[model samples]
Target: MAMSVIRTKRGMVKPAKETPLTTLDLSVMDRLPVLRCNARTLHVFRHGPEATRVIREALSLALVPYYPLAGRLIESKPRCLQIECSGEGVWYVEASADCTLHSVNFFDDVQSIPYDDLLPDHIPENEHVDPLVQMQVTKFGCGGFVIGLMFCHSICDGLGAAQFLNAVGELARGLNKPTIEPAWHRDFFPPQEAEAEAQPNLKLLGPPPMPDYQLQHANIDMPMDQIKQLKSSFEQVTGQTCSAFEIVAAKFWSSRTRAIDLDPNTQLKLVFFANCRNLLNPPLPKGFYGNCFFPVTITASCEFLRDATIIEVVKVIQEAKGELPLEFGKYLKGECVSGGEDPFAPPLTYTTLFISEWGRLGFNHVDYRWGPPVHVVPIQGSSIIPVGIVGSLPLPNKGIRLMTWCVKEEHKLPFLDHMHGAMDQEPL
Candidate 1:
């Protein structure tokens, strides 16, 4: 649908009172460029003229406690990042679309959906002065509407971002205050003296070079029965219950790695982020915000991955997930305080498969006066990087959706066939 902007305004949802200088924690993740911004799209059946005013008012109130969101990014040091508590405010826009919501298909390939039309008309990466957060409330002909949220990833991860938006939704429903007040303990990963030694040049020196491979988008759904079958097969083989994520991740890793067809001995790595809130010694409070997760990498030779069965590959991933708690503890005790290894760093190679899960992020329930959203789509986090966003299907159909990015166009059919083949295979 063609969208026409009717108005634009800046909302200075300042804290109830003036906030003092608040520095973002200098953790390893705080330095990476990859974790810079995230976008989420919410669809509603109907919205009245008051919808815009109501949402803005709620956002203003929500910003009272989440003041950092309205702040601007500042380069504290060469390899560090921070936020200036300037109370600058976020950009809000209201627009109208020509087509009705019924005309749009939310389940189609994400590319078919006009992201520019659905989201705020602003360059995601502006060198002048980046907006920490921005939003667009788009109205359609059939009383339908969409709310798009764009936020800097440096300030928080998906979980933290959800907390902020959920707060706004709660306020829109006439709640006096959000159920949870966010906790910002930037110093959570304080640097340790032991990790002060020469650290690898984990800080990306410059923007990544242009890629030779053509990037494309793909969305695949795996039924619950197939997922259960895969899990059961794994348990039967090793007498160990495998999580849906473990089984699916292993399947994708094996299938995609094979489809890419790299050198036989090339070292392939599967990278994913693990929430560290519960992994911490004194678990972070339920409301603790900021980047609470760290990257966990599992590596194997190309030959091993290509030859290994889904069950075999899952074992490797299971071990990595099981040991992350211990590894994270060692990280905190050693160099986390002073920024040891860069956990959020970009993948060293195009061959490294990066998987991120948003299914459990609680995005579907961001109700704002008009019940919960019918569909919540992730418009951020997929770029030149080869990322696999693990999402969920709507109710009545229990399953998972694998939204893949940057697949080589030539390998598109092969990639899809490879992925679908894995799901269709009978249980071992």
Candidate 2:
């Protein structure tokens, strides 16, 4: 079915009231050239009466506290990025689709959604002069609407972004102010002076992009009951408790590896971020909204990963988790070697896979009067740095839902089989 989204209004949504004008420094992680792109997502609500007006007004008021989002990223110096905090405002668009929510099946298969039409376009001359955020609200013919947002990765991680959106929702639902004020204490994770000399243009810094991969998207559902049972099975055998993310992600990685069918000798890497908010010395403030996660990766040969038992892989993941403090210390000191690798500048290979776990990020709770969105998921695009990454989040039924780009098209069926088999396997 062909769908078209027509824009009815577009403009900058500035803070409801004037905000302070100041220059804000970004954390070292935020300055990474690899995080220059926007994090896009779609929030589908089936009953937003005045979707655009409510969100637009709420966003304007929310901006007063989260003023950096209303600002623009500027390279105060060469390769040095900071928010100008001039209150320029966020790019906002109001749109309408010709179809109904029922038509797209409430975006269950997000891979099929027309993201370009839903998300704000980004053709910036460069990363330095772009807004920290872009947003669009599209109303369907059936009163349902999708709020498409692009939050700069340089500004907020999964947790931070969710916090901000939840606050906006609070305001939209008639709250006079955010329950918690937003903070901009970025220098807490001081920037590295060396980064200023390393890359010319942020986008051009990485290795010539991997030839465009013809990947397939697989949406795997791990019902809570089955995921819990599998986790218990691992605990009974390995005597090590693993998180839902650990259990599910490990199974997913193994399934994907087997499906890719790469050379047995090929080195493979699994990359994911560990929230480092509490990992900081003083710990981030209650309302801090910033990039506070560090990439944690484990590497092995394809043969090893593919043949390893579920418990074996879970141990590997846990071992990687245990080293986060040590590796993070090295990252802070600029020792980004393979052991303490950075996802963006890693020695990427065809066998590398990136997993981003967002199940507990609380995105499903970002209510804007119409209750929570029926579906909230990333609007994945290939132009982004970890193009074919795997994203895990919670489905409406509270099951583990994985949106994967790591599966090769030709291996799709086997990949699903392997994935479901891995999850359904006995503990031992």
Candidate 3:
């Protein structure tokens, strides 16, 4: 496939009038908030000869269901709406037939991608901490191409977006239609009211107004072989069944807190997310939307923090995995109302945040009539710096293939060193 550059003006790729839905149902907060977000980009690629046919067929079968994604975010009288029923919300672009399908790119020179680009950027600039979701697909002069995916933390958590992308891929590949339909059930999970409060244990922290915090980011490409080796080493060294995620997380968290002179007496919490699909009393259908998942915290006291071995930290995180239940969800909802805080508010005792992409089962499949993406990355978010670890099988070469990112300046050396050390350690 030959590669080349094509720069169309900003609005050139805009979808047709009939392309978007007109009368959207934005009664749900999730659907409404999407309106307030306006991050956009252009994906460039070498139009594949075969890609044209593939996309046409894929669109025929996939368009009906996937069409909703094309709608644009719009503000209505009372709230924001995804606005598609009358046909105005989705985004789409096509490569010329003569171009190699693999040679595609996404352009985003207009604005510095915001930390919550994937989500709505409603917060003021002074409060921003994470980068927005803004990705560009670039086709190198060589036949190679890459896909960039940016996201804001407010919209969908990592796993939630992955679920949506996976559905798109299924449609593209002519696989099973997405069994779990998306349900904007945000009405059921409103911000908590203070009178409905119970425990005041959950702490919420906001970024300092106009605070100066250096930001940094890293992308680690680990093949499966290295990942397996790292996992095995972690277990041997820790005498625990360390998952790639747990091991890496332990390394980053320990290093960051240690470097920042985290107070010994201060309670440290590792906030990891848990997908509550099967944990619900009656499992939520695959399509049920809204925030069905919640954070599961592993707490460490000053004493525990100062004296515990790396293995202990891993164990604490591992054990906390068992705490996800339907009641916990209800507890979180009630806590939100009584606390008068956003659901994404910083945890009272949260010191480190870990989001593991170790078992992201469906990312590679989002065909969309075009071929699969070469890469996918999450943009940063506010208040909390997140460490994401993506797991991939070993490549034909030597090491494991993994993808990781952190708040650049805050994490760089410590995060990298910890990952290197953890990867080098032998599992118990």
Q: State each candidate's clash count.
A: 7, 0, 93
TM-score of every candidate:
0.86, 0.90, 0.65
Best by TM-score: 2
Instruction: List residue ranges in candidate 3 displaced over 4 A.
Output: 1-5, 9-63, 72-84, 93-144, 148-160, 163-207, 219-242, 301-307, 332-343, 347-350, 354-361, 368-372, 381-386, 391-411, 426-428
Model 2 misses residue 232 by how many Å?
1.1
The models' CA-based lDDT, in order, is 0.72, 0.78, 0.45
Candidate 2 Cα misplacement greater than 4 A, ranges: 121-129, 190-209, 336-343, 383-396
Give model 3 RMSD, 1 decimal: 7.6
Off by over 4 Å in 1: 1-28, 36-49, 123-130, 191-209, 333-343, 346-348, 380-383, 394-397
Which 10-residue window in model 3 sums to the lowest lDDT?
A: 7-16
| Candidate 2 per-residue lDDT over residues 219-317, each given as its tens digit | 888788997887888888878688888887788788878887888998888888888888878888989888878778788789987889888888999
- Give the distance in Å from residue 279's predicted Cα in candidate 1 to where it truly belongs: 2.3
